[model samples]
Target chain A: MSTADNPIAVLVELRDGAVARPTLEALTLARSLGTPVAVWLGTEPDADAVAQLGEFGAAEVRVAAIGAEARYPAKAGAAIAAATEDASLLLVVSTFLNKEIVTRLAVTTGAGVVVDAAGVEFVDGEVEAFQTVFAATWNVRTRIAGKAIVGVRPNTTTASAAEAPGAASIVPISVQLPATRETVTAVEPVAQIEGVPLAEAPVVVSGGRGTGGDYALVTELAELLGGAVGASRDATDEGWISHEHMVGQTGTTVTPALYVACGISGAVHHRGGMQASGTIVAINMDPDAPIFEICDFGVVGSLFDVLPQAIEAVKAHRGA
Target chain B: MRILVTVKFTPDLQSQRSFTDGTVTRTADDGSMNELDENAVEAALQLVEAAGEGEVYALTVGGADAVAAVRKALQLGANHAIHVNDDAVAGSDVFGTAAVLAAAIRKVHDENPLDLVITGMAALDGLTSMLPTALAAELDWSQLTLASSLEVGDGNATIVRHLPDAHETVTAPLPAVVSVTDELNKPRYPNFKLIMAARKAEVMQWSLADLGVDAASVGAGASRTTVVDASPRPPRAHQQIVTDTGNGGNALAAFLIEKGLA
Candidate 1:
């Protein structure tokens, strides 16, 4: 295996019968590269997982080089090195643990690595990566030529519904797994917020400081639209919503198909995270709130007053 | 149960960072070394604290000011300190940053080969977060990242790494990489003694050539990532400042009507 091939490799981050939404977006970005392949490690790559990935346009999905372990993130890197052999660049979803794996892979392969990319694309026949930085204060665009790896931020781009039957074949690369002085025997999922992960939800209804702890209207509106609920950092920090539901610089970055903000005064930090949303609808008492700047559709109102009517109208439209 | 951690000196992230005449201004106060870096230092300290008897060493790459960050790690209870500094190493990005740290790690390992190399998931200033990965690559080590929690036992590292909105616990063998997240632990403050000791201790500095790195590969040239256009996002034109009075529900209604939401 030589570096001449230089195909892009996406390190898959899948768990418990589901592919992470970011992985889907990475696969979408991977399509721009000549032939995109994924190195699935830890858990076995299954049919359902492969199917969902296919819909996202992966040209290939390779099995990881190492087995599940009590303490190893190197498997993804090792797997990418083994599977993509000649890949010039590698893309991994940023997690606290896998940074080491990608780092090690970059070292073994001598490739440069970038982390927390808000957007990654093929720019002028070169791979350019974007980072949403400074507490979501600014957007920094960068690229490292020759060989590099990038850890992409979530929800920067929507996964394409385009289908590509990636190579589903699994291969066990022969490599010595590193020795660990520690071990974890069991793992469990954390408690999820009432709303689903905003990145995966096609529709997200978020509130800002303006909501005044009155999610009543937002919930009704979200329920009416069959969407998840979110909050700006101001709302979450103010305890109007949980930290998990907070969407902003330190929180989740979502590019849902539809995002409706209620009572959010829209700080640049909050907008940095949600500006990618396809259709933005805002409802605030102030017509000049920053939320209005990015919103494609808006209604200025006391959420308390307009929400009930809006839900009723939606319900009436659904005939329930 | 001894753990050694590494920290980097970077531009303050929370501060409004602006380059004046191609040089960073100190008008911006020092934020945490970097969130990811803090996460890494915190992770190592946690493991040592959990073990009860082990010592922790925290190292940094930079000028005298970096000692402040190193002292921070010390105040947090790092048992040892190694400051890798010098003029030759200035302006190194991740690759150069990795090289300097690798030398320091080798020296520290010679004293005691660490069971783990913990780093922040990524530096907010670099935003590349490649140091941990690059260092691990240089060391040919295993790694786990975005760790919400990390457990060290049986010569292995197990952690709950965040992916998307969910958290997954993963285990990697020893001599591995552990880059962590701020969600993992709240960093403890340094006591007066450790902070004082950090002041007295010397940080070893290395030049770019001494690290066996090509000057072209680091700093302005070696860095693959470049900022082509940097600008403050234009302020929003529609900054509606609405004060909610107790009876403004009606006012809010009228305002909504004015905006056509009513």
Candidate 2:
């Protein structure tokens, strides 16, 4: 039985052996709900990572030393379940892998789970999650009946340090991992695109069929803005860009501070993925492109003509 | 090889979706098979076809209108269709739904051992992507999800999962549960003969009692989450459209600078 004062466990994801940015954001969100306890899944974190967690208001760090087996989602989930015995709610960064882990944890603990949540709040001692559904057309609020596990989307909350640093005492816990039938035979790394990840990028510049199988200009503009380069399904289908860079209902859904659609006629499918962006700008040759309907700024012109000029103007402004 | 593929009836992606009484309002006219499940159906068909001596069963759990989902699978060359429909099954969350699915799967497995159970990576409507893992846990079966490519040979199933971080090749023994992504293969359209036959095909219907699923354990009352409120997001405000005349790029840059987003 969890009271209002019970600790909330925030699953800490480590990238390159450091706490990931999204986990920091999750920790920040957890602070308002309850005492934030950072739960690290793998081996012991270094001093810097622990300090970082402490800086974000995690009063204590529960380390589940699952080690190499953490690659298996079930094993990691079990570790979390064991480590978070005193927690009222579990917060995680919503990735596909994390979703699976939290699902297993929810089942094992009989907890209610809501993933891809944009925000969460406590209402009358119950957890309520807010999310956009059906491609950002509707906003839905879900209330968990019992113990809650929320998989929050990346970039939904800003990561801020606490006014006073937390204790950040380290606690190591042991878990009994279940045997699984599935075996990972091999793992091959894929070269990641440069700049920020598409889902977490503050600015996203996407190209479409109008790019004519060329992403040079799109890449250039995105680089100038310190953003990620994205592509429409048509552009990816035409083999102009890899599938990871595709943004649509079937691909990555990004909620960036600024979204620039160049040479793209926004279909409802595409709009569903990015309509929630803070600011939208479109440059299309077609005067009546649907992208213009939702964009805060629309330019009816050739992206080839507009992008280069925009690039130069940005450069001139920065230099000035 | 005997395989079972799970399908879902969902509102068309282009339809106007709404929630009534804290649940998605499903009408017969506005719903069909989930688009992503086509890839699962296609994978099942390909696996059975390659084996040259196996049966493919398409199973769906929903209201009466959900029969459309299995019928769509039948048109795609599935040998059998199963529709598990009961009023008590309404408003079930992913966990409750998984329990119902596992019970139905057990009933089918008892009659004839199933070599594999397959599903889509995620249902387009819910987009939770959690059912496959939940169902696998309920059944205590090996779960191989998000497979971009799958193969079955020598009593084992292998898949290559293309995740954001890495591409992993995983292998599991038979009697596993697999969920495939759209990148696996292009789903084939229904042929004329199969389409005609599927229209008149008899679908096996089962109630909660038939599958021995307790009504109290698998409906709105059993769900752990409840929808508190739902509404359409307001449209964007402050519209600005400009026809670029050489100075368009400068205007875009100026706007970005003003917003402090440059």
Candidate 3:
């Protein structure tokens, strides 16, 4: 059992004065381990920000904002190390930015760092992280020997608002980072798309080679559901969609609550990424398609015919 | 200028995957250069060719069969190939792997003074994406990772990272580490002549002893984390398949409604 002195520091990434979805999920998970503390990197947490963190059960908020020149990974690591010195564990979202900072922390302190953890728990008074490895073919339960730093995957669990809000207190920190030779000269944001990002979407509709180079039905179904659109390697390789939409071993690993595989033959390579999804539904012309083997519901028919009607049914049902 | 590009020999993603004890079974499937590392090799080749005066060395660490990774790099036009292998290095975790690679990199730098170290975003088998930063920390060098495009000028490396939501350009001075994503470039296929030549390329082999890596500090026992349990994923059972008799869509919707998804 964790005592009140052992807090769990949750890395809260902010954008335009709002906390990101993954950070809220991290706070939810942190609450399960110990007293939740929000670690904000950009600026002091305002009242609104405190309320946002409080909704997810953060007990305190720690803010560290250095000058632009000293805000690299080393500095971030120093700040986290100093702020969470007595905390039992630190939870960070598994984005590239956070991974770099966590790597630096691991090296600087010789602390064990686990990346892309799908679940974290306190087992027998120790932290046990669940990792999906080998294309999700094998699940590994890992325990870090000493101080633990974990990179939790986005959207692993649904974020739920707590009944009672947390009382927020401000903790300040200062760290002098070594001179960095690296600097960012420019940033070009990706073109805005219609749906939510693939990693964060709760429902995902994906297509593959069976789409025959047309993703019209796939896109329509995804948009109607207010979810993200994904593609298989064959679809992305054939130029039917961007590589970013591909879901497979070489591409993004997703664990959405509902994974709709449209016109996709679930190969081992492709299944490795999405096999961990909560529920799977497959639509394909071939009944023998491997996708049907793992799906909770399977429809063997041409997607061109089935998707249109399915979309209509979904729309009509939601309207009622 | 001298550059070192790191690559890995990974199990073919298409093949059936297996695990022995706590480690993955690599030999069960045919292995090749990690698909993503091919882009790193291509990036390194382009930078060297653009400069018109430099050498690209390829390095890898694994079992004996792992040398195939470096050979593939040679076929892709790397000038030198180095393979670090030893029984003691087996089952090395990412941290231990980083320590060994850092040592080998230090040795190579001692001999030729590398100006840049390039790598793939992540190895397909592990997909950790931790090596580049760990390498940079070990060498105390600047790190510019996940670069989708790269350019070298004025003793510095500039990269445009292709993040999911944004493209970020970062620069690091000489003697830094940069990892490139697959979006950087389309890797080229090795011609027949280069393939045949790569078969005969001299692959320098070194061991833990040569690089001063202690046996006790690496391998499974020394790993900070241990895989406590692993089991075969349970097969999906009792799948309900519906053949579209023109009412298939309604059935699927009904199923969704029953599951509370709609």
Candidate 4:
């Protein structure tokens, strides 16, 4: 197939059997590149998901029926490769699992892969991806020569419905998965956070050493803003919060629309993970906290004092 | 049991990092064994210590400065150290680097079978987190990545992988590749005796030809991507700071309200 006609495959991730917010954003991104072909890795998606994908400009929904084994990267990567044989580029939500799958896919297909991309575009008929590196201090533009797999971070692209939406045709695919030694013995699903997933949350409120092991105010503010609660390495290391909620270079990297750092020192490691946030707001007792340098708005005060008043003001605003 | 742990030398995270000619500028003065690799070395040492009769080989593929990675692993109590340094290996992407690592691993495996290969979750400089998966693909081995906790016995390795959504327990047979997260274990500081011994240890060095990998197929020429442009991101503009007497929360809320971020 010619490059012009080659489809842009968007790997659709599902949460609760529905299209994930990041996948929708990816579909929206794929539509601009070419014909958006939604690639579903597991069992067939219900009609609602198909319709949702279609609304997001997926011209076709290709379901790779790989069953339970699809959770494995080798199996899932093979299925995706089989499904996107004619695709010029593949776009995925840049989670750790998806990065592995795409990396394996790139190895198998000899395609270039770039993950944690802030944006990707076609320049001079070649794919160029924009990403932040070195603790989000540098912006690099990478050009992929041929077939490419770009893992885009959550909240990077706006999820929008197509202007001219239509019914998407579903194409079922069967893949012959290769033999691998890895086996998933068991999966324990963690209890879901009350609101959005941390990575995909539009608003994130993170606490650090100043929380004093008390996440009560942090959780309250996060709930009030419909955001996700996050912790610094200090808090996680102190066993104040689970490691999954830790945001840093070694932990989860979040790109939310609004990132609120409370009493966090904003070490470079922490900054590397969250510096790309759209608008940063920091509340800390220390005026010299590094977070204030990057934050669009900063409040120098104890979070204990600031958060409660902020919470009440937010409530009042919502009520008004 | 035998294990091979891959380590990398990377620029210190605190250093002023920048890219030159589309690649990260490297210097021996500012580079050290990647911070995360300490966890990999620790995991390997613990696994071997538990096995009671096993060896751990620390391997690194890079330029001259990269040998420091394996040396650090040796200081951490690795029984053996191997450094693959070749000019052609410079500027290699993850795929190219994986090819070299896998070839070196195969050479070691041929000498004596390896039970597992362990690596850090990701390199701090690149932070791609793709090398372990790429190495597994290149070696045609099972890949168990992002392990927060791990256990090995009965010819199989089981790992507890903590993800944002779920906690998954994955198992893979021996001869697999596993990448561990920092949550796995606290790395032990090198004792004075081991540190002194590591300083005098002879590191086995090899070239691409020695590993039987063609230099042509694993360098910038073979790379599928090129960095067209790079620059330091300009700082955030119009920053505002407020000292909260009592209305700090009101100001915070008002700021969010004005920005439509609330």
CAPRI accuracy category, model 1: acceptable
| Recovered fraction of real interface contacts per model | 0.31, 0.84, 0.79, 0.92
- Candidate structures ordered by DockQ, highest first: 2, 4, 3, 1
Q: How far is B252's C-alpha from truth in model 4 (Å)? A: 2.3
lDDT-sorted candidate list, best first = 4, 2, 3, 1
The regions of model 4 sitting more than 4 angstroms off are A1-4, A317-320
Worst ten in a row by lDDT for model 3 chain A? A63-72
Please name the candidate that would achieve the greatest lDDT relative to the true structure: 4
Candidate 3 residue A69 C-alpha distance from true site, Å: 6.0
Candidate 4, residue A285: how far the Cα is off, in Å: 1.8
lDDT of 4 by residue, A1-320 (tens): 22325589999998877889999999888988888998998777999999999999988888887777878887899999988999979999988889888887888889999899999999988999999999888999999989999999999999999999988888888789988788788878888766788889998999999999999999999888889999999999999998778898888899999999998999988998899999999999999998998999999999999999999988899899
C-alpha RMSD of each candidate structure in angstroms: 5.9, 1.8, 2.7, 1.8
- Chain B alone, TM-score, model 2: 0.97
Clashes of each: 45, 0, 0, 0
Q: Which 10-residue window in model 4 chain A sums to the lowest lDDT?
A: A1-10
Candidate models: Cα lDDT each? 0.65, 0.90, 0.83, 0.91
lDDT (10s digit) by residue, model 2, range A1-320: 22325798999987767788889899899987878988997777899999999999988888888887887878888999998888878999888888899888888999999998999999999999999998787899999998999989888999899888765888888889988899999989878777688988889999999999888998998999889999898898899899999887668888888999999999877887788888999999999898998899999999999999999999999999
lDDT of 4 by residue, B19-131 (tens): 88888887789888999999999999998888788999999988899888888999999999999999998778899999999999999999999999999999999999999
Interface RMSD value for candidate 4, one decimal? Answer: 1.5
lDDT of 3 by residue, A28-120 (tens): 888778789888876666788888888898877877776443246777887787677777689998877788888888887777888889989
Evaluate model 1: give its TM-score: 0.72
